[model samples]
Target: MIKTSRKGEWLEIIIPEEWDGTSVQDLFRTIWNAPKKLTHSLRMEKGVRINGQGADWTVSLNQNDRLDIRLFSEQDFGIQPSYHDIAILYEDDHLLVVNKPSNMDTHPNSPEETNTLANATAYHLLSQGEYRQVKHVHRLDRDTTGAVLFAKHSFIGSILDHMLEKREIKRTYLALVEGILKVKKGSITEPIGRDRHHATRRRVSPSGQKAVTYFEVLKTDHKQNLTLVKCFLETGRTHQIRVHFSHIGHPLAGDLLYGGKPTFSRQALHAVKLELTHPFTEEKIICHAPFLDKQNIFTGIDPYSI
Candidate 1:
């Protein structure tokens, strides 16, 4: 568990018994998920410490030794805040969950792309007088709308990211694909890799990293030749759900990149639910985003029931 102290905006966590003889830096990298780029600044700036004193990177830690790490400041991000209407589904001092709108990039891809979810979050944090770093735990595609989670600072961000890597943070998506699923529920265990034929696309390949997606058919529209499916991801990859479903001959509607027709302006996908156990509180937490438009295919049916 982690707690904050008022003295220096440092987050504190006690080393557990399992990590009794581990090096400080190694533990930070593995358990805390601190990236290598942050290591130099963390050391030179006295950003990390143990037992109320700056400790050596290779110092062995004892159980119950308190470790503190300084929070990354806002200026480090180097992005100007841009105002945009964003819906915050949940918020705590440690975490922020936003219902990201379609067509908005989850984070900035280039210098020219300032109007992104990160920029909007920066503006929101500034308005709240929280001049600290905004770190997204995971990413949603530009045209996919859903719950996007962010950590308010680096320490929590690291922990949350570790949880994500461990598959502790569960995400469920609603996808409208262009076919009637023959099966009620099934798993797609396919490896995905960069498509050499298409520069920006991914395809199922044996040389690629392992990817798995599970789906349950929720509803079918024979007239539209579409089926709404609830999807669970076992692994996260670039365009994983879209690519896997497309490979199974059910490309998401409007996903032209994957051979889907333009029935909708963008791919018909939404991250409807997120469930996880709070790292600090150890309590179960779940958040959801409501449908943006009632006119969509899932108007009358309840997603929870399905």
Candidate 2:
């Protein structure tokens, strides 16, 4: 029941406990504050066990038996909400901006039918009784939370997609990094591509497409070596921030792909601000989301603290 993960805060386990099937949930409540569902927090999401084997909750528990239960800090099958129900930061006839949370895949995936922000936004549109299309302008990484845009119609969606292609849309992110960067601000220009064996992963490759990221170290703790930095995207690529930072040997905290530990369950990157021209209005629209304190922008630990 105890699985080790660098990205996890605690271990989740289920073993023999002196509680009956009917009262197991209550016992869980007494010992740990968790949600009602198990799959909710991939780790803390609980299952039934009897006699050191996986079973249904209908099985009874024996007295003086050893039971194991560990908590996956950020993932709790129903403990704390994994994501905010999409905070509508801005909305117009053509578009909507949402304050996204970490830990959620932007869209649905195989066997993991967890609710997604896209689905939630689509439902919101349906709630208004409007048949308008809610097309995602772009997607953020599953564990990277931040500002996201949706187009209410195909026309606007197409326009926004073009804007992204032409680099007309500007995105800014706030991230918590592991160490003090020597420079105050700089650009990371690199080519990135897929890792052949790890097809789901990416790596810095000269043969890959052009990618650029600009970053500024806003603050740092000499003691902790941890720095608070802001990043600007020149070319939006999958895992750009995580990859760029990792390529420089300072992956953002909790970003597993580039060697971040599960010190935090979610990547410490937030799309804090964005700028672009409205498709129809032709006016510059700017939106800013104050830093989400949840990601720990900068801990007082120095890079050497590790």
Candidate 3:
């Protein structure tokens, strides 16, 4: 996943044999689905180049013509490094993935906040001579622990934003919910909207955006009245898993915000797996985050066994 904050970046691609006869405009329209804004921007500026010369939408392509396009760019946010620990899950020239701990915000919500995953990642990158700003692709609640991906440049981030819109990125979470659900497996298709009465709460509403979550019971502890489940999200929304499970009377353990018992300090949710295709390499990448050892949430079973 090419989640990043950098913009005005460039990408180079070789025209394939099958697209030899297609015009540059056709290629952008059909193959890349270039947004109108991008196409317009490229048209106005010398943003597109074929081989080594300036090219436009009307230019014809060949078997090995190189095409370069400039992607959208955004101004620097100027977030500073906090020099905190960020467990590096994967790193490369274009991307970085890390395991974010609970009690840490993914990114600072305000200018006054500095202790966030983004700030820590900035510090780490700077230590390695990465002077560019940090760009995170997704958001995890302050209490949600799991794999968060970042893009080192703006072009990669743009690709990732498209992937997110296309539902190409997959995230799997392990949750310990309060009750042993009657159904072993089920799907929650609900519309989630901000709670009108409470500024920070969400609820199922007819006018809300569509949200879907699929859950499978991994283990059940009837003695403790807790159930370990694997959750797959179909839509990325604020507190989707917590709110959906709570709506069905099985709020996550320690999720007091959603009517769950405070068995742990925070919500009993861990983003265990993330899978996506690399934007540049086209290779499938999968990342996993191990459960926090000290939590003791999985008291009766070895988490590895599951």
Candidate 4:
């Protein structure tokens, strides 16, 4: 069998039909049955997790074992703006790192002229009449908030692309989930692939690409779980954090697409920090978003749901 990812990629798997995913996509594509964009990455080959060992699909599966994969791609013309003052973290001649808020797309996809973060950037450019082209280095889902890097031109984008490939960029997120986590810390290592039957779903399969995410439980209340997790992206797969967390049984709160309860209308995940080097200076830059950090998630709200 073959597995698909959230980005519409495929892989071969040799296992029983009843496994979590015979192919690779059985892990992430749950909300919809869409294909994931499966890109290649040599660095993540070593990070692949198969049952207990790190593998790249060369090993055959046993009976009930599982496989995990993660990968990333960098390709977008511009952003789709929600028309808001996007918090600027770091900016220079070559590139800019914007702290993207939730409900704003990193770039425009199927629906055009709908006003997204990318469109806002273009609007900003038009105000100057220079009309700098938007080069999207990274993206965030419309309802998923976090840091997004954008380039002004293709030349600079090339450099940023190489930086991403080299694993120079690190993204961190904080999410509130709906569950009482038993483990203090854990890692969700799975292979992500697209859903062939549906257009927007993903699954985990031994044959799919590789993905690894490390998570830590901060605190938990009766209604929700507050976790301060650091998702190290060995491979920057699409919806990696959301899918992996969902796979681990702790779906983010308000994430209707990934087992999360629709509590806040949008997912409770926030891209709180980012680490990377400047495109030209090579100076390591770390940007932090100001979210009320209580170490314990339940500290912010009453024990009972309001």
Candidate 5:
């Protein structure tokens, strides 16, 4: 495993045995997939070093070599900080995972919006004396509650974005739908596209992007005709889960937009867990968000137990 430490303004990384003889350029381009512009900036600004001295970008690395990169210099926290309470699930120098509450947008739609999760995250970072832009890795709907990942710096943020695109980050969700599925476990392989009739709705389209959702039924409330399901996504299409389940005649209990029953106020969906590989430290990271609603259909269900 790679070892990492935070200095005043630099991040110190110790090369591991497995990366022996890997060229610095290969590490940036192949391993991290850093943008060429950012790589040029790092080289021009002398932001990278080897053993406390300036680094030669083409030189091969050795095990235990000290590689230092200036990543966390104080900068403006781009978004306006909102001083509201937020539940942080996991945090480190490289990443943060926060338990987002219901009825909160992931980020602002306009500059005047301060009641967003990103604004609250900015406030949390400022409290720690770290000033960096709020960079969320993924997003949840306005009413969906769950663990959201954030990158503390742009370098790691870019790496995470690539990981998400490659589907290396596993996102698991817990949802309560209006009916018990005929099959206990199944996968939905459908293409989804924007709904022309509505501005913010998606539908399964024949010529749309490929979307896949895997699900396993966890429990069934036969009396209420509701089913609790654990869903995994292979693609991140807009409203993929909601649209897929709705297409199968089982809309989320409160997802009124897709013709669901008004069994609850908001959609009965929550991002229960996130699993990913740490970009720098090379460690497996798992974050879980417990059910956040007080009077939802999944009250008795324990998401962590799954």
Candidate 6:
């Protein structure tokens, strides 16, 4: 594990034996894969130091050397802080995972909109004296409830964005569909495109981007003709789960946009778990959020147990 310390506005890291003789430039570019713009800004702002003194970016680092980077300098939260309560699932210096509730958008659509998970997260950080901007790594639909990941700093955010692009981050979802699926386990490989007729709708079109969804049926309610399923995504797209399931003739219950019955309010889908390798410590991190079955859509079904 990497040893890190926070001193005022700077974050200190002790060089490990594995990283011995690595140049600072390689650390930022090759190892961390930081953006060129951020690297330029760090160099221009003199935001990096070694052994308590400013050091050249090309200099090689030795084991046990103290490397300091100004990561926590005072900054705006970007979004207006909303004082609404948010449930934190996991927290660390680099990232935060929160259990997002239903009926709230992940981020604001406009500057005037403050009732969002991003605004609430900003307030949470502000209360803790963290002035860093609130940066969400990914977003869930407004009605879909689940675990959401947020990066505390831009450096880690860029790395996480890359991880997500590489499909290194695993997000599992629990949903209740309208009908019982014939297959217990299956994968949906389809291309999803925006619906030209509807502004917020997406459909499976050949001209669209690639989307893949894998699902397993956990439980089925024969009486109500509802199936509880756990879904995994290989590609993240707008309404991918809903679109894929609907394409297979099992639209999520209460999902009106996809031709589902109004058995409940909103879509019966929840982001149940998020798993990833910690960028700094390289530790396997898993975050789980409780399923929000407000209308008892999947009565007596415990998502955690499954």
Q: In terms of TM-score, which candidate is strongest? A: 5
By summed lDDT, the worst window of 10 consecutive residues in model 2 runs over 72-81
Candidate 2 lDDT, 32-67, residue by residue in tens: 333344323322454333344553433445553334
Question: Which regions in candidate 6 have their CA more than 4 angstroms from the true location?
Answer: none
What's the count of clashing pairs in each model shown? 0, 16, 5, 49, 0, 0
lDDT of 1 by residue, 1-306 (tens): 433344446667677777789998887677656677667778888887898898888989998898876764544455777899999988876788898888899999887777899999988988988776788999999989888999887767878887999899999999999989999999999999999998999999999999999999988999989898999998999999999999999999989999999888888888888888776545677888876643374566564553
Candidate 1 vs candidate 3: the TM-score winner is 3
lDDT of 5 by residue, 53-157 (tens): 899989999999999999988878888998878899889998899999899999999999999999999999998888998799999999889999999988889
Superposition-based RMSD of candidate 6 using all C-alpha atoms, in angstroms: 1.4
| Candidate maximizing lDDT | 5
Error of 4 at 68 (Å): 46
RMSD of each: 3.7, 22.3, 4.0, 17.1, 1.0, 1.4
Worst 10 contiguous positions by lDDT, candidate 5:
294-303
Give TM per candidate.
0.80, 0.67, 0.84, 0.65, 0.98, 0.96
The TM-score-based order of candidates, best leading, equals 5, 6, 3, 1, 2, 4
The lDDT for every candidate, in the order shown, is: 0.83, 0.65, 0.81, 0.60, 0.91, 0.90
Candidate 5 lDDT score relative to the true structure: 0.91
For candidate 1, report its TM-score. Answer: 0.80
Q: Is candidate 1 or candidate 6 better by TM-score?
A: 6
Name the lDDT of candidate 3.
0.81
Error of 3 at 113 (Å): 1.2
Cα lDDT tens digits, model 3, 1-306, are 222222336566676677788999887676545567767777788887887688957867987787776653433546977788778988876788989988889998888788999999888887876665679998789998988988776656766777887889898888999988889999999999999898888988889999999999999989989999988998998999999999999999999999998889999988888889876445688888776537866566443443
| Residue 268, model 6: Cα distance from true site in angstroms | 0.8
List candidate 3 stretches off by more than 4 Å.
1-29, 38-47, 68-77, 298-306
Residue 215, model 1: lDDT of 93
lDDT of 2 at 97: 88
